[model samples]
Target: MFTIPSPTIVNTSSRPLSETTIVRRKTRPVRVGHVTIGGGHPVVVQSMINEDTLDVEGSVAAIIRLHKIGCEIVRVTVPSLAHAKALSEIKQKLVETYLAVPLAADVHHNGMKIALEVAKYVEKVRINPGLYVFEKPKPNRTEYTHAEFDDIGEKIRETLEPLVVSLRDQGKAMRIGVNHGSLAERMLFTYGDTPEGMVESALEFIRICESLDFRNLVISLKASRVPVMLTAYRLMVQRMNELGMDYPLHLGVTEAGDGEYGRIKSTAGIGTLLADGIGDTIRVSLTEAPEKEIPVCYSILQALGLRKTMVEYVACPSCGRTLFNLEEVLHKVREATKHLTGLDIAVMGCIVNGPGEMADADYGYVGKQPGYISLYRGKEEIKKVPESQGVEELINLIKADDRWVDP
Candidate 1:
């Protein structure tokens, strides 16, 4: 319900129904298995399997379930040497079953061994720049001098060099995923624990990879705070542009808790960036089951008109003028025609709010009286029917017009 003005947006739609159209940022493509991200490819939807990585069967099943529901990329945590070794089995099982989904190893805290061991088995490996090779910051910390800072950077490079070389040799990719909650001590000292610090943490690792002449890299700047999340990603894009580094970006709001708040926060943060054309891949980090995250991802993409995966419903908030059971009727309509995608259906409460109100809707259903319903096709009044028969009439209308498809 809150609205703010943005002047940089260009008129994207010929009709201008929404605010400015989002022009996607152009970046070099990074291959993660069979999926192509960036370089004008469609934004990829990804999710992390919550099962333990060592539990090969559980993890493999999770990935299969995710793939069935449209997840394009998947990540599994590799916290131990065993977990790192398990990635080979997981990838082997996926291959054996003819599932081509890419596996990414998420490694943190002195992950050199795991990273090196897992790199060749999976399509990509994700290292948290904050914890990949740095000591965790404490409440009481010693400030390092300039010389010490350089020494630390060199130490990090030494730690990561082997893994980077392995990834390069294997033709695999790396995601320099930096979370706002876990900023490195060096960054905290130099830039403070802020969005700037988050960007710097990622850049440090990215610079290391580039120094090695490794270009198969992706980047992410994630935070639970919407403003911080958005700010960090935007800064990353600007900095990448300035440095002429076009590595693909992965967007998310970390620790976005379960249910409606989680969905809203994820959407606000991810959607804003997607609207600005910044993200190359996205993962909605809900505390709920990971499979539940897929539909929400597709819904956000569909709402922005960036992708179409299902039917779009545009119903009004019913007022006292509402003549019938608006929610009941709308639900029935959705249930009946959920398979007809890329079409906008509006279920309005009254005529005064129908035709013009749902102007963007491809089809409209409006209450004409206490027991009567009116229908329209893109603002043209199509017919009226009894309220009791309204749901069936709407389906019949859609079928009559060749819009119905069996699910």
Candidate 2:
């Protein structure tokens, strides 16, 4: 049988066997307007507005709405030159009417001219490497020769140079955003429809930007499938490490459909990398309103202990030993203290395991008897109150500690 070690016999000078903290990867900071990504900054939350860029009023209002509710960076699609020009008006209006929110422009399909124009207005320009210098795929071609591959590569460089130079001179950032569904034909021919293709496509663009001495860059390799998305980002990080590159990564699972499954799918992929210390900025791409994506992003960050924007509640599942209605009482307790940010409050159904299980909480509401509930402050039993008065007493306890804030 395994034996437990005695505390008196344990070495006092030795470090703890393990730590719960996550050690983040080292990466240089890339600024998106006033917000920073990587370089030990807290993970950033982002969402894209679905409004058309040409509708400047609607787009500006949407950007302001998203920004007011914790979206640090807002993205809009620019499909043509007119839409790109519309951003200039949208930006000016935001400054005049609301705040100068950080903006990113999404450009695709041979968008060199459009990107250059939009780059003048936005803080960052995001380009899909596969579509930026689009080439209609030759249906009969099976493979690419070295000469043909290099020839198209040179074309990409020429087309991308002007926009790179514009963003560089303007002191702005660019995202080498690659999607699995739209990888370049040459990359598809060489690397097949694999994660390798996604990484190579992003790298080709990163190299072009680097060759121009422009490094204000962020990289993303997003795939709709969770496994493919996970693999692509891991491979990208591995390749970047091998090449001594420290560009920040933007993480997401593309086309994660609406409702519970979408949130779960995104969290499964994005949260896995974050736990491994990989991602810098994240967007939960849900099919719901852009506002819904913000909460999901913050929830993921809060659950991981990386950011705390709301109260953390700890409740025990009701059992036969439970002294009260756990579900109902938990709801009441939460409603009362929901606005107490940065505080951990526990709601235990019984005293048998309550004090021990909720030992780490800042404040605890635990059942002590059939008609009474005990209030605790970090494992110390402060008082026992009638069940009807438990939540109010807990609030009183917080007020006594001077931690209660009026909601």
Off by over 4 Å in 2: 1-17
Backbone clashes in model 1, listed as residue pairs: none
Q: Rate the local accuracy (lDDT) of all candidates.
A: 0.86, 0.91
Model 2, span 1-407: residue lDDT tens:
12222112112112234757766778889988899988989999999999999999999999999999999999999999999999999999999999889999999999999998999999999999999988888878877899989999999999999999999998899999999999988887777788888988999999999999999999999999998998888888778877999999999999999999999999999998887777899999999999999999988999888899998899998999999999999999999999888999999988888999999999999988899999999989999999999999999999999999999
Q: How far is candidate 1 from the true structure (C-alpha RMSD, Å)?
A: 4.9
TM per candidate:
0.91, 0.95
Off by over 4 Å in 1: 1-19, 136-141
lDDT of 1 by residue, 280-374 (tens): 89999999899999999999998888888888898988889988788888889888888777888999998878888799888888998888999
Instruction: Tell me, by TM-score, which candidate is best.
Output: 2
